[model samples]
Structure formats: structure tokens, C-alpha cells
Target chain A: MGKYVSVRGWLECDESTINEVKKIRNDFTATYNEGLLGEDKLELYQSGWTFPEKQINWTAYVFYGADIREYHLDFMKKQLSEMANIQDITGYFLIDDHDGDYHLCWQIYENKFIESEQENIVFNK
Target chain B: MGKYVSVRGWLECDESTINEVKKIRNDFTATYNEGLLGEDKLELYQSGWTFPEKQINWTAYVFYGADIREYHLDFMKKQLSEMANIQDITGYFLIDDHDGDYHLCWQIYENKFIESEQENIVFNK
Candidate 1:
């Protein structure tokens, strides 16, 4: 039995906005020496995009390994809420391995509404 | 001056091959408690693809933060050479924040021939 997980989310923001947020978060982490949202996490990569010519904004991915639970999800939501100037969160995809198969869960946030669902999403070669 | 670096490489292999290689590498790490190729590294994610119907194979991305140098690149080449049945490395992308801007480099391996080049690859929001 092995455990591996990943989360991907896309955000709508400009380069300057993204850089500002990242700088703030990085400084906070350095000063506090604690993980974001009180959870041990590390950003893998954050990349900007230019698709449809001014339709899509920036996209970023973060990776962390810990017991996945409801508390962590709640914490993530609260932290995002506190951060200003962030909107239009398309959705979030969670991938975890359980019982020899990958399990996927999605949460979409639109118009201040949120919805959750589960599906079978596997990444195999 | 902040130093952040990332490397992206795509490999074309089958799912079973990817899983087998991952398991071997994981077990090796656990048993020996040493990084692959004598370098401290960690695999971020390995995902398969289905496109063009049996033409494209699996792809994987591994992330590790260390001082990027010639020795590490040489080590990576040697390790990949040792791994059998792995081929069709479309290319490898290197991104680093140098001089307050992002620098990009590319390497393509095809037909057993490798080419190196550089370009401006920025991921802005």
C-alpha cells in the first residue's frame, strides 16, 4: 500500500498580482517558519498563461504530503478567502491513491457558490 | 537575489513501465535511504497520457531543489542511460529565476540524438 496525492488549481490574475501574492506568502513563510494555512506545504510551480488572448489568467500547482482530512480542506478555503483580489477560481482537482486505484474529487467555485463531486481520474502510462 | 529553479522532462513509456520504474525507485530509496543517482531528489508526479490513439505514451515530472550544476546534469544523463526500455524524450525544459527574470533552456532527445537550445519561457499570470 502506497499513498501519493496531488492538487491542481487555476487562478485568474495578472503577472504583477501573482508576483505580489507570492512575495507576500514567501515572506510570511520565512518569518513564521510555518506552512501556509498552518499545514506543511511547498509550492511546486506557478506559471502564467496566455490562451484565447486575454481569456485565461495564471495557473499554479502546489504539492504537500500529509494526512488528507476535512480540516485541511477547511483551512485551505479560509486562507483563500482571506487573500484579497483573488476571484474566479475555476475549480480544484484532488488525486489520491486508495486501494490500488486513484480517486479524484473536484470542487468548483463560481458566483460565490461551491459544489463538490467525485470521479475516477487515473494517470497511467 | 532569489534563486529558484525547475526542470521539466517528458518521457514516452507505457504505464506498466512507469509504475515498475517508480516502484523500483521507491523501494530502492526506502531500502537504502538514499536519493536516486546519489542526488537528493523526490518525484512529484508521474501521469500517463492518451492522445492520438496509441501514438503517445506515458509522461512524468520530477522536482528536486539543489544547486544546478554540470555534475548534476551529467549524473542525470548517466542514470537515464542505465534505465532500459525508456525512449522518445521529446525534450526537457529548464526554468530558473536569474537576474530578476526567468531564463529558459531546452534539450530535445530524438532518434538517439540530443539537441540543446535556449529561449524565453515565462509562466506569468
Candidate 2:
């Protein structure tokens, strides 16, 4: 059962935080084959946002294999937990089968606050 | 000066339109070396959305080389113009230098209603 998962969200951070993320990207690349241009990872897109809410300052996309999606999710939580506690940051995780079998979505808040909105949506798998 | 361009937006379409997109994906792969798993194209992520807005039903991401970004932009306009004309559809185009030299953004509405919001954002180039 092959699953495709995408995790994306808006990040609120300053220059220091941005640098930290860059460092993380570099470290992730070296550590795993799931980094950008790596084996499991496809693309990592991050951009500063135009719309501002509270300290929300940027947006990030982590496009990697869903097989290790949970691992990456935990990584994200650990990395951004400190910032999210003091600031406001939110993102979403979406999962679906390659042939349109399953669809899972979760709304993620600051402290790994995840709220599952849907699961087993279509059931083709 | 290599540029990275990402074109993405939410699409409001039915199964028929999805089939059309799939057809386009296939045809594009054959026409250019910039399709899914092609040389220039990196990834194409499309997922059904849980959030509903009017007729907004889907989301699409087109990750490709910026060398031919304009061409792809035009193609998208032409392909989705019909759907946007009748319904509500919107997307965004963001361009940035690989080394943080430039940043450009545009808001795309139905019928190619594109509005430039930012340009020459930084003097890194």
C-alpha cells in the first residue's frame, strides 16, 4: 500500500528562525536520503509570506514519502515546538493513496496539537 | 541567473475536469521533457480539499524549471480559463532567485485575472 503524504504550513519566525530552518534542511539532507533532491524527498519549497497574522512570517512545504511521514511529523514538532509555543503557527498534513483509496487530513497547531478531520475518505485501497 | 518558479492553486472541478488534467499531464509528458518524472518537472501534487469555498474542489501544484515558467503559466491560463470564467478559481505564481536575489509574486484569479503584488523584492541579484 503506497501512500503519498504532503505536509505544509505557514511558519512565523524571524531571521534567526529562518537560519535555523536552513540548517535543519542541510542537516536533514546529510542525515537521510529523504532530503530535497534525495531519494524519498521530492521537493522542499519555502517562501516568506505576504499576508501576515500575528508573528506568522513564512510558509514551508515538506514533500517526502509518506512511508516515513510520521517520523518527519515528529521531527517537525520537535523542531518548531519552542517557537510555536510563544508564537502562532499552523499547518496541515494530508495523506492519500496513489490510486485514490485513502485520504487523511489533520490540522496542526503549535504544540503538536493535531486534529484529525478526515480518514478513510474514499476507501479505494 | 537561474530562477525557481512554483505555480500552484486550488481548482474547483469535477471528475470530468480531473480526467482532463490527467490527460493534460500525459500529453504534456509526451510533448515536453517537463512532465511528472520528466527531466525538468520535479513533482505534481494534486489532492482533494476538505475546505470548501463556493465551487473550489481541488488543489494542484506544478513544480517545474523556471527557465520555461512563463510558457507553463500561459498554458495554465489557457487550460483553466474556461473553468474560471464560469466558476471561482484562483492560484498564485511565486518566483525567486536560487540564492535569494529576487522575489516576485502574482495573484491569479478567474479569467486570467492576475495581479502583480510584488517584484524586485530584493537586490540580491
Candidate 3:
């Protein structure tokens, strides 16, 4: 099998965004059939939604044990980004990889997907 | 050596908070001398600040090749969270580990650091 990657992020928790994420969660992932999406191309765990009401409307979502081939992980991220408008979305995409486990961070600023320096956490097993 | 963990996160970008992070980064890491902090215990890379103006004042940050022994990584995280008031901070700690690279996400909501599901990105190598 291929190597594994972990994911975690935060977004504004609104009714529409929450519902859109819920739809994706339902549409993706396999129960007993073949694949979660179309064929049997990938397998991963996407966490449910939660409200923090921490100064801002926050919903912490997660996708663990993600398959990193053909940008499948990236595709899932794209789907989530579309859940709400850019103004309603102020989040980042932090993907860590090999050699030295360096983190590549991407964030939304003025409706553009910008890659810059930010902060995140990680634990190795 | 131990396995590697990747990190990427986002928070509000402010002059004071940015200055705090800049200080911590300076205090840690070994450029040429001995260890970063006090002794030769850990080796890590923490990224700098960036303003995205992405609807909200956003700063995407990162930590790569972090040392996890003796909770050094955890300590660094604690320091960063203290830079600003709870209302000015909103971030998630998505740590990835072995067996399947599962992500453990923790966030700050309502002035309390909460461990819940969130969204982020990861790429395996």
C-alpha cells in the first residue's frame, strides 16, 4: 500500500456549510460496497462537525489516514472549500510530508488560495 | 530516530501576536551553536508570520521536522497559544502519527482549548 497522511482544519460553522459538509460525508466513504466515492480508488476517515462558538463560528473537521495518490486528498479539500463562500471561509490547508516532515501550509486571503507561514500541530508514531 | 509528524495551522495575524511568535522562534532552534533552547534535546523548524487579508485577518503558520520526545513539541504549541487573548485566536492542532497516519485534532473555542474534529490538509511522502 501507499504511505498515509493525516489532516485537520477549522472553518466557520453555519447551517449551510454544515449541511454541505454533511452531504459530502454521506456521499463519500464506503459502507460495505466498493469505494466511498466512485470506484475503489481511496479510503479515509472524515470526522463529523462540531461547534465551538469561540469568538467566531468555528467547526473543527478532520480527515485522517488519507490516501495521497493522484491528489485525492487535495480533491477532498476542494470539495470542502466549496461548501461555503470565501467570505464565510477562513481556513488553511496544512499538509505534512516526508524527508523531514516539513509542513506545506495554504490559506485563504481575499478569496485567493495563498500559501504562507502559519502554525499547526503534529505527533509522530 | 523517531518517526516524523507534520504540522500546519492558521490563526489571527496581529502585530503583538506576531511579535510573540517571532520571539519564541528566536528562542528555539539551533542556527550554528548548540541546542536551540537550553540543551541539545530537540530539533525543529517553526515558520514565520503572513497576512492574507482573506476576508478575515489570517496568518498561516507551520512547524516542520518537530522533535516529539519529552513533549517538546507540545510545549512549543502551548507557548504559541499564549500569545493572544482567546477571542483573537482560533486554530487547530492536527497531529499525524503511524499505524495509519490518523490525525488528532485539538482546537480553541470559547476561551477553552478543545480537542475536536476540524479540517486541514496533509500530503504523504
Candidate 4:
């Protein structure tokens, strides 16, 4: 039986920057040689793609050993920070015990720096 | 532009009871004469159908007049209670300003009666 950690995130970014942000996941997988489990691992549920005004909504899940969870989270944090136009990011984590059980454990959201930047961007606009 | 409320829920139920809970959505729609918009309105991302122990994950969004939001919430509460084998239900709400903006606002989860009931079921099994 394997213990798995699932991560889901909701983000807001410039419409032009969505595709670039998605590419980071692929790059991360290739660099580490350990990829997310399934086809839906990184699904972009919303992109403001169709509506142009709506923020982007994304969710991803990974199944890996418990010992490696922190490594993965750190990797994600670094990758997310590199995203140029991300105004806001709200994420949460879930765990699966491999015995048919899952639990949501934590959440993270945009910080003061991101908030101040967002304000500046909005004010400038 | 319109203002909208989004709802997301995570539930754990018996494998055999998945289909029954899904039908409640349809019944609600028919009774109200208002349907969830667009495709993927009620997406069942997980059902433990594959592993037999994982809980069910569901998410949905609706757009309508603000005056009717409470009416919809009360209606959902009634429908959810009618689910027979639901061990737990944790749900949250979000709001969209129709200007490409969204925010998560609230959450609800399983309670004591259901918790005790679930314990009995597990103990018996």
C-alpha cells in the first residue's frame, strides 16, 4: 500500500501567462524523472480561456512516499514563485492512506508581497 | 456581467451508493426547473470506484441572481440529507463577480450523528 499526497490550487494570473505556468509541471517532472501519476494530474479547470475575465483554476495530485512529501512541496513552491504573472495562489493538500481513505490537511494562499503587487497592478490598470 | 456562487464538496459514501447520490442532483434540477449550466456541471472526480476505499469528490458552480442564493443553499441541504449511505459531506462556497473574479467564502462538514453512525457501520463491518 502506498501513501499519497494530493495538491490542489486556485490561481489568478495574466491571461497571457497561463500556458507558461502549466509548462512548469512538465519541466519539473522531466528534471526529477519522477512524474505525477495520471493524465489528470494537472488539469486546468478554468483559464479565463473562454470567458477572458475569470481567473484560472487548477488542481493536481501526486502519489509518492511519505518521506518525500516535503521535497515535493518545496519543489512546487519554487516552481510557483517563478511564474511571472501569478497575482494570487491558493492551494490545499490532501492525503490518501492507500486503504481507501483521504483527508485534507492544509492550505496556503497568496502572501503580502503578492497582495501588494496585485494592488499595484490593479491600481495601475 | 453577473454575480455567481460556486460550490465544492468532498463526500465519502459506500461504493454502492454513488449512483443514488448523483441522481439527487437531477431531481433537484427537475423540481426547481433550473439546471446547472454548461457541461461538467457535476463532475465526479473520484468515487473509490477504482480503489474501493477512496471517498467521492464532487464540485459544481451555479450563476444566478443574488436574491436566490439562499434558496439554492437550503435546497442543497435538503437534497444532501436524503442521501442514504453518505458517511461524510464537506462542502464550501465561492463567489464570482462576473468580472473574471472569484473567491471562496464558506465551508460545511459532517456532524456528530453521522459520525456516530459511521463508526457503528465500520465496527459492524
Candidate 5:
């Protein structure tokens, strides 16, 4: 009921990648399966469209009632990039406990994750 | 522990609306003030840039462990549109109960909330 990570981003995909994208989403939707991750849950949304940008965007939140799912973002990025059609994963994931002003902004990947120095710039709160 | 709604969209803002936008977010941030909202939780995220689009995007999730916050989206849209510089809420909100495939797609505003037929379109999952 406390810790959570926010995922806000989009995948650059083309016609060849659409089915794979949906398949990946079906995999993520498995988070709703009973007893999979305990109280941990993920509410994922895909909004916007390809008419304007030709890419679909995703907005999601991963909940950790008591334990943060370690390397969850890494797993997500890996899955997203492993697809043949996903050109890129653009955007960041913010780890927030709602108890501090500073939070981890996961945006860069250089063998591992890097913190984005944009909590105060790209966001207002 | 089950029901959740996802929010993903951006506000058309200028210099005049920035402060007010931050103030509204501050008010929403008060949801973490100890005992507010009971077990209900909200994880809100702001991302993207104003350089290429001149607008920032927000992705959020509102959890209703046992009770759905009725009229929550209505109140949100009202609050978002009541501001001066914020232009429009261009995206829709989807409500999935995790028990059915037919969920509510709320996007249209014609006096009351209208359902958006975008569960399959705009989204692959």
C-alpha cells in the first residue's frame, strides 16, 4: 500500500511490430493473475495513436505493497527491446515512495540503469 | 488490491498555467498525508518535454483496494479544464476490473462521461 513505480513512455514501432507489441502487452497483463506477485500489481494503459505520431504510448504504475520488485524495469526494457519491431523505448520510470522529494528516475541504460536528472525539469511535481 | 484506473495524457500549457499546474499537483500530492484516502492510493507520474511538443505528459494510476472513488475522473477532468492555460485533456481513461474483457473506456464528454471505443483501437492490448 506504499511503494510504487510510475512508467511513462512509448515504443517506436512500425507495422511489423504491432502484433509483437500486443503480445508483449498480453504478457504484462498477466500481472493480474492470482498470486503471481502477491499484492504487487500493475495497471498499464496504452493511449494516443499513430495518426499523429505513428507510435503508441504507454502509461503504467507498478505497485509494491511492501517490497519493490527488484530489476523489474530491467526485465521490462529487455522484453520491450527484444521484440523485432520495437525500434526504441523512449521515456523514463520513476521510483517514488511518497516520502521524499528525491526519487530515482530510470531513463538511461549503459550495461545497467542510470538516473535521469529531470525530476525537477521535465516535471512540475 | 484489485481495481485500478490508468491516466495518460498531457496538458496544453503556457507560462501562465505552469504555477497553477504545479499547485494542483501539490494538492494531489497531499493524498500521501498519513491517513488520507484510507488504503486507496494514487501513483502519479509526469514525463516528456516541451521542447518538441511544448507540452508535458502525465501517467497515473488510482487504486481502489475495495471501493472505487466515484466521480474521480469527472472531478479530475473538471479540475484539469477549469484552469486558464491548460488547453485540453486529449486522452481517454480505461477502467479494467481484472475480471472481464469488457471494460469502460471513458473519453467522451457530452454533458456526462461517454465511453470511448478504443479498447482495441489506439491500443494493441
Candidate 6:
């Protein structure tokens, strides 16, 4: 069997803004690759296209691996939190494999949604 | 112009693990849709095909909208992090539009990389 996960969502922004974000993303990746494998491996990790085109729009970003473990999940959350803080993103969700049989998914909307959902879930409970 | 962004990276795992993550992702999206807009929207978000297929394996996941503001980037990071935690994903990167001119990209590896990078950067600085 193949282990895979897909994350899909929308970023409520305009074209110019999206382009700027892409540049930053590219730079960050370059920096990371440089830090990881030295300057030699940087080209290997550099993104091909400059603009966000093709299936990238309104499409799902997918990831695959051997098993979905707790450590992986925690790492993802921390990274996401850092990104959110850096970029100031508001809402999003993640769907990932859980254990070897079940799946787990969660969504983080704006603070308003969070507050409302928490209250609702609590009241319902 | 239209806004767009792409996030790409490899999930260091086996095939079975990838499939399991996909199922969880599908379910999570379904649940989010249900909670937000009722069950009707769930189908819209339910990922088709039972298994991971097509360009999903090694392709970049994309998102498009208006602008790449702090809020949007923050949201993407947080979502990615949460997914990482829930699914135990090890490594990943996100490329998004920033401001109205540049693009932003970042990578998050394991703790081993983090500690080493911090020390290396500190030494260099």
C-alpha cells in the first residue's frame, strides 16, 4: 500500500499579493536547502517555475510517506504555526493519515471561527 | 491578475503510509465542510478516488486567491504544521505569493536539521 496525504484550501488574496508570497517562499526554500546540504544541493531543491500556474491554483498539495506518526504531526503543527506567524495567515486545514487504519483532519479558521466552534462544540458536548 | 501559490516537498515515508494519510485528509476535509456548511458541502470537499493517484505523488499542491498577506502565510504554516503533527510528516516546504511583488518559500525538516542549522548560522553570524 501507499501512504499519502492531501491538503487543500484557499488563500483569500489578490494576484499581486500572491506573486510576492511566491518570491518569499522561493527565497526561504533556497535558504533552507543551502543550510541543509550546503550550496551544492540548493539548485536541486529550487522550484522550477516562477509564477504560480497550472494545477497549483485551487488544487490539492499532496504528501506521501511510510507511516503517519505523532512526531510527524507535531512537527507539522509547529512549522505551520511558525509560517502563520511569519506570514500572518488566517485560516486553513490539514488532513493526514492516522495510525495505520484511520485518518485525522482538522481546520483552523480565524479567531472568530475558533471561538464560535469551541463554544458550539462545548455546548453540544 | 489572479493570485496563486504552490507548496511542494517530499514526505519521507513508504507507499502504504502515503495512502493512509490521504484517507485521513479526505475525511478531515469532509468533516470541516460538514461543520461549516452542512453535509451538502462535504461531498464537494470529499476527495475522489479511494487511493492516492495522478500527479498527487510528486506534484506541488497549489492555492490561489487575492493576496499573500501575513495572515495567509501564517494560516498555511499553521495548517501544514498541524497536518505534520496529526500525520507525523517529517519534511515539507511551502511557496506562496508575498506582498505584491515577491514570493516566499520555507522548509521545515526534523530536529536534527534545526539544531545543526541554528548552530551553523550562529557560528557564521
Q: Which candidate number maximizes TM-score?
A: 4
Q: Per-residue alpha-carbon lDDT of model 6 for A38-115, expressed as tens digits?
A: 353233232222232322234333222222223333433433343343232343343444232323323333311111
| Model 5 lDDT on a 0 to 1 scale | 0.35
Query: Quick one: how many clashes does candidate 5 have?
Result: 2
- Model 1 docking tier (incorrect/acceptable/medium/high): incorrect
TM-score of each: 0.31, 0.33, 0.36, 0.41, 0.33, 0.30
Q: Write the per-residue lDDT of candidate 5 for residues B1-125, one digit (tens) a residue.
A: 33434343333234444555666655654543443243223332212111122221332221111113333444344434443224432222344432444344444232233444332322323
Alpha-carbon lDDT, every model: 0.33, 0.35, 0.41, 0.32, 0.35, 0.33
Each model's chain A TM-score: 0.40, 0.41, 0.50, 0.36, 0.43, 0.38
* A52: Cα error in model 3, Å: 7.8
Superposition-based RMSD of candidate 2 using all C-alpha atoms, in angstroms: 14.1
Give the alpha carbon lDDT tens digit for every residue of A16-80 in model 2.
45445455545544553434234434223212111211121123332211222334454544434
| Lowest-sum lDDT 10-residue window in model 2 chain A | A48-57
TM-score of 5: 0.33
lDDT of 6 at A21: 44
State the lDDT of candidate 1 residue by residue for A100-120, as single tens digits. 353444333442323243322
Query: Ranking by lDDT, best first?
Result: 3, 2, 5, 6, 1, 4
Off by over 4 Å in 5: A31-85, A93-97, A108-124, B1-125
Candidate 2's DockQ: 0.04
DockQ of structure 3: 0.04
Q: Write the per-residue lDDT of candidate 3 for residues B4-112, one digit (tens) a residue.
A: 4434344433445545545555555434243334433433233212222111112323222231433344654565555334345545555555444546565544445
lDDT of 5 by residue, A7-113 (tens): 43333234444555666665655543444333223332222111122221332221111113343444444544443234432223344433554345444222233
- Alpha-carbon runs more than 4 Å astray in model 4: A5-21, A29-31, A34-85, A94-106, A111-125, B1-6, B12-15, B33-71, B83-125
Measured against the native two-chain assembly using Cα atoms, what DockQ does each of the candidate structures obtain, in the order listed?
0.03, 0.04, 0.04, 0.06, 0.03, 0.05
Model 1 per-residue lDDT tens digits across residues B1-125: 22333333333334345554455445444453224333233222111111111211122332222233332344334333433334433223343433534344433344232433332211221
Find the number of clashing residue pairs for candidate 4.
4
**Candidate 3 lDDT, A1-125, residue by residue in tens:** 43434343444334445555556555554342333244434332332222322211123232222324333555555555554343444444555544435365655434455554435443321
Who wins the DockQ comparison? 4
Worst 10 residues of 6 chain A by lDDT: A115-124
